[model samples]
Target: MFANALVSFEQMVSSYPGPLMLVTILCPDPHFKKRHHKRRVVQKPLVDSILKNLHPGGQVFLQSDVLEVALDMRNQFDSHFDVLEHITDIDPSVLCDNEGWLLINPMGVRTEREIHAEFEGAKVYRRMYQRRI
Candidate 1:
């Protein structure tokens, strides 16, 4: 698997054999400093690439141990909802709760970071964006 931080996600999306049905970004580095924020993996170019290449009914799954990062990622996708008709349309009963946090891990598996975060009593934030038909 390619490392999200070091890899050009746009190029990865472009070179894939077929439309991506699912894209999962789990616990991306927050890059807390304002100047370093540019290194975030959820930038517009990557978002655009996913939007352009994701097949209809595809989904993007995002989660982070840090609330700020999670919200930032969510907002990035939120801003694109207007143009994509993907974020706003969803089967929420299967995806998330009323407050927009996914109640269950859609992947059905937890990463070591997730388990560690939970064990340490840190809150995890999650959201899903699904393309509309």
Candidate 2:
């Protein structure tokens, strides 16, 4: 993934788009263990490049089911950008659809792990945050 990003970065720079809005999502499985957190997608280099590319008011969103990853992301982002909203704090009204409908993603569209967890009746946690404009 990192190699792919490096290649993409090179391509983007060569093409020179108007601006970039990058979102880095990280969710390391439990088996990844403490030392392997470095393997996760969200890291200092990625964040720095993203910030450099993003135009003023451009936002970045990240999500993770792992508590530690979420917390670490929160801390890292807080240092560089103001927190616009946290998923836990979002008002239900803001999450509604264009027709003022509340939407829920059904299990049918879930990832393999999500499907397994649903069958096992396990609870899943999610966090969302956006970078400052």
lDDT of 1 by residue, 78-131 (tens): 887754443434553575566678777878999899999999998788887787
lDDT of 2 by residue, 102-123 (tens): 2332112455554565577754
Error of 2 at 105 (Å): 9.1
